[model samples]
Target: MRKKSVIAALILATSILIPTHVSAATPKAGIACSKAGLTRTTATKKFTCRKSGKKLIWDKGVALPQATIAVPSPTPSVPTTNADLIYVAKDQRILRHLTASDGCANPNAATAHLQVLIGQNWINVKNINFGWAVTFNVCPPEQLGKKDSLAWVEVYMDPGTTYRWVYTGEVNISNRNAQGNGISGSTTVPLPRPVIDPHPVEGGYGITWENIASRVQDISAAAYTDAQATIARNARAPTAADNFTTYLSPGAQSIDPNIQDSITLLKRTFTLYAAFPHPSKVFFVGTTLDEKDQTYAKIDTLSPGNPFIKNSFDNMYGINPNLPAGSVFTNSKCNGSDALRNTFTWPDLKAAGAILTSFCPTDNPQIHVEAHHGAAHEYAHLIQIQIYNYHNLRAAQPCWMTEGEAEWAQTAVSPDFSSYLSLQHLHPYYLTTLGTDYSVPTNTVWSASELTDYFANANKIATCGATPQYALAYSAGAAAVEALVAIGGSEAPFALDQRMANGESLDQAFNAVFHIDWAKAVLILSDVVAQKMTHVNQSDALTYQTRP
Candidate 1:
């Protein structure tokens, strides 16, 4: 007998007022319910309790549709106008309305149209129809006081195509001044060609080396022919004896017998590579000796007679004569016992020369191979520099080509040296480590796409240095040269150098020799390296032939 019971009784009275034809037992529509969230279903439809005004009642229900379907209406098309072509200044609000002074009041006024040259035809850009005078005011507010009327429009241009703004149309009475005078003319202003900066301030455009090569002016036919002739003249076969003279330092006579054997091996390596043209002389300076204090003294004693020693060592050590002779070996710049080679150009004497310095004692077999093959490696660099008549190999070519070719040269001279076997083993590890950020995995062989992306994004080796990245030039670089030789025959790498000496870029030389672009050659080289590293078995002696 509470208020809730009174409301329930009144709902039952309302149900009695329903028509007899409609089923009063089931929930039809507009029926009272006890509370919300209640559902009732019938044979034809389903119903849910919904709030109607302030009362909870069974409202309209959903019913399944018949088989008959209705078609949808077509969408309307929007017209493009001059407003769509107008350029909006950055950080400025869009101008919604144009006044009479904006120059649209004169419908027949002479206007300029922007057109771009496409296949010998000039096509209108964006249908931008507007008077040249009004362009100054419509573009930006600051253009009002400018002497010349100018405006900007957004349009994509195809490379190597020309574009211009054309002025046309007729003047009408509305465009005339109060004195009944009007200015009318038709002309065209050519837009300047766009310039592309190879080294942009903002990075990540992935511009290839070919992009930069294309901008350089090509060498003349006469110059190219002359370079080819020079290369052919220098392409002689190896001789039985050494063609260049060797000068041994005073300390070299007193070194261990094992070191002397390494020097003999270096001379044998030089004789093998003597087929290629090089400098006339080479000096052998042994930094290690029985007495350490005599190292700099021996170099100084040889300096006055030898121009290379005078210019390089005498100039460097003579600064402080009081410094101990052993200080030459202890200087942070000088390696402790590594073999090194340096090429010097004597401008005053009008000559060039090369020198090999061996500091290692070669106490063991591994050190002996290193000293022997290491000297061969440095001599190969001299050959490369002289072949191209270049001062530095890294300047004319990339570090990979420079160092890799040297590594290849050394192995070619001494196939049983075992240094290249270690390099072959290191190649895979270096590639995998360097390519980590680029999604190159270590467990599987790299695909062409993966290798391409890795090379594209990998840190470029620009110079020959001691860093791990620079070390890649020796291992992977040698593999790349092997691939090149396999593709273009034995002289392909040197042929590339010859062409580059004729003032052609690396991409141009690559195409001239291999009949392929540098990018494609790189893809093939990388794939070959990956395959050799992951699939092939390395041997102590490199069986790959350097010459046919």
Candidate 2:
């Protein structure tokens, strides 16, 4: 989802909360000392400031003095490696700053003093977390040090672009020596390296606008071929991989191997990279289609390569364009194109047609059942059916259960079902059904708070909450299921199996597992729901929506 940057402490936005007093706000003649500063080796370079009540009082215009500390042998020779780019000695630390900018406040403002390493080996700068650049024979020996005493670079982007610069200033190296004597030993010297772009490339990634055009034809063709094959499988009896591939290739977009594996793909145009089979490929899936039959390209959920991708996908797929952009669509009914039509299980079309016409005369008077579902609803049905599969349909499950579960699962693939959260807009008939008699009881009704609590606790582990309910039901409904499972105590083992066997309602499955009658189970479920509601005020539900 959202790009985030972590600088030691979660330092967020720069406060404009500064005093607006005419003289007090004026910039000093020399170096400025802010709460944000660089880490230095010598203590003498430490920033000396005090808080006058709520305001910060500083030695204005005075360059906080500094000295340099040299590393021992193996002083980390100049990284001559040929990477796509090289950071000036100090650029390594600056790079760290850039990573933090992913979520930090106005990064440009935070890194006003920062500089980047440019061009060849510009010595006299500090470098950390080096990488190997094959062409130039340059690289860091390892990844970023989680916590290192040695100062690390922190890079920040210029508010609106990929261009990033470094933050350079002195830090306090002394332990607890508060007096000036304890700080006198530390020094602030010049950075050890320079930030340099080997290619001096304008855009960060080597790929250019021209490169994008060159690859567009191939990418589009590949997506088309893949979609066709997937649809062919859907028309017949498809395997899990086939189903998964279809989901991944929505909107007919091909994927990049590296991108597929990167957790960031969720934010990218791809539909289900993280949920897909392969973990390493840089995958790219097409977004929901537009009325014009085009796919929107979102780079990492937040990074929209082409801004119009949203409107186009939303219009064609009937998705809520205004919903939180990064949240996955869990209720979408349609697929990009008409792929489900081929997913008919029957082999002989004539025989199947007769069977369909005779059995579903009211639904298929013209024998065109496929068109009714279309791509959206067909995919929706598939999501619900896939969980249980035809093989598990022995027990006569209730229609409400089936419909609700299917409706829930549809949202997993496309979160549009959450539109139901707008309870006020619900049709009069639907609202009546949402009340206690048909829904959960007054004591156990799935309220927003209870749902939030269940999700908060359930996300603590994977195996503990494997039922589709945790994913599809969401909010209140999810909480009800969570409560049912908790009280019935059969949630883990019986959920999936029960749903498959007889299409059991979540409540029915719980009673079966726990060997309790439906009435008793409902009472226990109510108790659990009430308990969850008590702590609902303290739980954090949205955390899982955008973690990492």
Candidate 3:
């Protein structure tokens, strides 16, 4: 009886222990799990609790062939920081950063420096310093709205190493006063050959190996050249007058007895521009008649025998090696047109001349007026070229400004010649296709983008042939100038040119003279163009009859 009682007690203990061990729930696929990474083993399979599309659920069990041993995962490696990227933002601001997350967060103050290449040597940029502890640092703005080949950035990484980023491409800074945000051009990676423990020398940004004195000299020379140009510009007022002479070609007299009348008109045009700044000696030669069979012999006889004049005639009619490459005037004869030449002789004797052709007294009254108008236009170019030379300005002014100002100058000679009226008459027909149409009509409304593009491509248009597209510089360009005149007075164009000659860009000059931004000016001009287009009538078309 005692042995039977002990066996009953052992069976009861086993039943209580087995029920306690089986109390926990079994894991099944697609069922909610209490904890992630939890696993369980059954007789047939092993299941794991893992993330299944945002929910912690028991994963499908893996078949258990035998008892398995678990192994731990290897540790992940940390990523190193990438080299710094430097680029010019669309608005012409220079920016530097390590990565999207990592910026120029330097702990040291004023360690980030900006430098500019002034000839061949890099010199420290003056007046602006980068001291901010931010993701990216904005370098000092240089040559705003224009490409600058001479700018770069440097940052001190440590006492033993300094990272440098040099722009391999031209960088243009924003014309706006505010800093730019997005990159505009190619990004430059940090130099592979790091600057090692570079010592800051005078006038250089932590570049001990460079000849600091030579760099200083280059900067000084550049400043001196600018100063000289400024002095030359200031020496003559816009209203100052200069001397000029006129000569008529033999063909001019042979073609028409009333050629003297055209000569008189040419003199009048010269007199009109005499009040403005001009080259010291301007020689006006007229009438290379018979457009298809034109010859330089007649022009040679009529010219003042000045070597510069001869060279200009050669360059205009024949191929002169001295002529600038891609010059629009190269082998560009005045056979069927008029032109201003010898601008290359500026600031010396500064010999310049106007070659008038295709117009004679024998032509109809309207054609006669057009001929004189063309002469007046060429004379305006003489004044324009002299001003450019005085300042030693190298960049060609925007086509709109160049041609529009010339068109406006026609009225300066005679109110009978009105560019404003001519453009008004044509505006209605060409309003919808201003940029696309080859007529280059000035009467259409303008967008900010179109104006910007026109301004940007002014040089290219000036250098190309006189396609209808090139005429935009005349028509629309005249309208822009007329708008400028209406807002800023007649002296506005001259003042704008003067400002540009003094080293300010067109945008800068426009803002300074008009007290308005380019976009704002575009809006105002658009309204002006729209009003002219809207007011068009039969009488307005008649007004264009007087246009030269």
Tell me, by TM-score, which candidate is best: 3
| Rank order (by TM-score, best first) | 3, 1, 2
Q: How badly does each model clash, as a count of residue pairs?
A: 0, 93, 7
lDDT of 1 at 261: 48
Clashing pairs in 1: none
Q: What tens digits encode model 3's per-residue C-alpha lDDT throughout 415-484?
A: 3224323422124222111122333344444454564555445533223222234455555566566555
After superposition, the stretches of candidate 3 with alpha carbons farther than 4 Å from their true spots are 1-242, 254-275, 289-305, 315-365, 390-396, 415-470, 530-539, 542-548
Q: Which run of 10 residues does model 3 get worst, by summed lDDT? A: 192-201
Cα RMSDs of all predictions?
Answer: 32.4, 31.9, 28.9
Cα deviation in Å at residue 13, candidate 3?
99
lDDT (C-alpha, whole model) for all candidates = 0.45, 0.27, 0.44
Best by lDDT: 1
Task: Please estimate how well model 1 matches the true structure, expressed as its whole-model Cα lDDT.
Answer: 0.45
Report how far off residue 504 is in candidate 3 (Å).
Answer: 1.6
lDDT of 2: 0.27
Which candidate would rank higher by lDDT, 1 or 2? 1
Task: Give the number of colliding residue pairs in candidate 3.
Answer: 7
The CA lDDT at 145 in model 2 is: 20
